[model samples]
Target: FHDFLSVLLCGHKIQAKLSSNDKKLLPFLASYLCAVAPEFKPFITFTEDTLKNFDAVIATGSNNTATYFDHYFSKYPHIIRKNRNAVAIITGKETPKQMQSLADDVYRYFGLGCRNVSKIYIPQQYNLDHFFNGMYAWKQVINNHKYINNYDYNKAVYLMSDIKLFDNEFMLLKEDTGYSSPISVVFYERYKDINDVKAQLEDQKQNIQCIVSLEDVPFGVAQTPALSDYADGVDTIDFLIKL
Candidate 1:
């Protein structure tokens, strides 16, 4: 949000869609922008009312919330974003540095961003040592108070149950088929054929934000996205330019 807002502060943006909670710092950020430029706030509105007072919209939310946005904003020229996660297709041959770099995609933003690598696709009977070694640099993240709380909670739940998990004293790895993993927990799956997995991912392109591999995108570069890297592959500038 800050990225787009900062760009618009050059005195050209018109409107934005924000929730009620998004305006908490409106006074501060807006005041700061006003100090930076005199005519900046005229084109901005921080309202939560559902009124058709804008030319277009960009709505982002979870998959569940996207249903409501699609229905309510169906008449508007809008881009509704749903829950999407990034994945890493590991071939079990990455160097130690590459593995450690991959850890950035997982631990960055505390595994909360859509670009975070929540699920990793590995080959059948893949070695786990390399995966563990790559994430060693971020092992210190476990010391965070909030992170350790979640870690302890998930570890206890998996322990009392019979779920087989791999624990390296910080993050927990579970062999699951799901893409969205909880904090301190990452889900992984085994794939025998890379082409088959690619086909499956292609079929569900709308459900994914990005795919990270050595050949595709370098590790640790997910969060530091380029301006052209539009979310959901919908060109925001193109839409506005057409408008």
Candidate 2:
């Protein structure tokens, strides 16, 4: 990490967005990096105005936020923007053990991270009982969280409001024709044929990060991502250097 910072500070200034809620962590993180390599001390800024003066820009945010960022940084010479997304994949021969392992990918961090599994495209004849049985353990932990409770309440209110919206409180609602982040809603079309599933996955290739399943599809991993993974088709160092 210190070596990377040394490379970044060679001729570049670092402008970062620090959430108001996370102000405390920022100083500690910055100080730690500087301790390892004192050269990084002069390159840090924590304001948006400072961000605009940079040679390039990088922004991490939800899909909604990424849209706004594109509009805001349109005139910049270079930019990298990340949007919200999650992983899902089709599998036909998953065993009980595999199903349990996949459940960790689904429920970890309460389905918040982009690497988390938000959807599963299983076959039409797939045994949902074993899948749900593996996931049953997470129900209590999910119920205990206050935000999930609020999400459940908000979904219920929307359902009863007579508004024209899809509402499936028992499972997450999926009608946006895109990904949903930080929630447990999955949207998938069941397929009888593997070729059809392959075609659908190919069509959504640009939108996906990781595809986890029992089948050994090309470039598919079982779960999670490595540190070297380039998110949203953008290189991390290339983003920073342009700025």
The superposed Cα distance between candidate 1 and the true structure at residue 187, in angstroms, equals 0.7
Predictions: Cα RMSD each:
2.7, 4.7
The collision pairs in model 2 are 56-243, 63-84
User: Candidate 1 has which clashing residue pairs, if any?
Assistant: none
Report the poorest 10 consecutive residues by lDDT, candidate 1. Answer: 2-11
TM-score of each: 0.88, 0.74
Candidate 1 backbone overlaps, count? 0
lDDT tens per residue, model 2, 1-243 = 322353364567667666555467666877887899887788766564545556555666666877887888878754444643555555656666666676677767666666676766657776567667656555665466665675686566656875343333334534344565335555555568878766876787666666676543221242445545666656666655544
lDDT of 2 at 4: 35
**Cα misplacement distance, residue 186 of candidate 2 (Å):** 3.1
lDDT of candidate 1 over 95-155, digit per residue (tens): 8998999999999989989999998999998998899999999999988999999999999
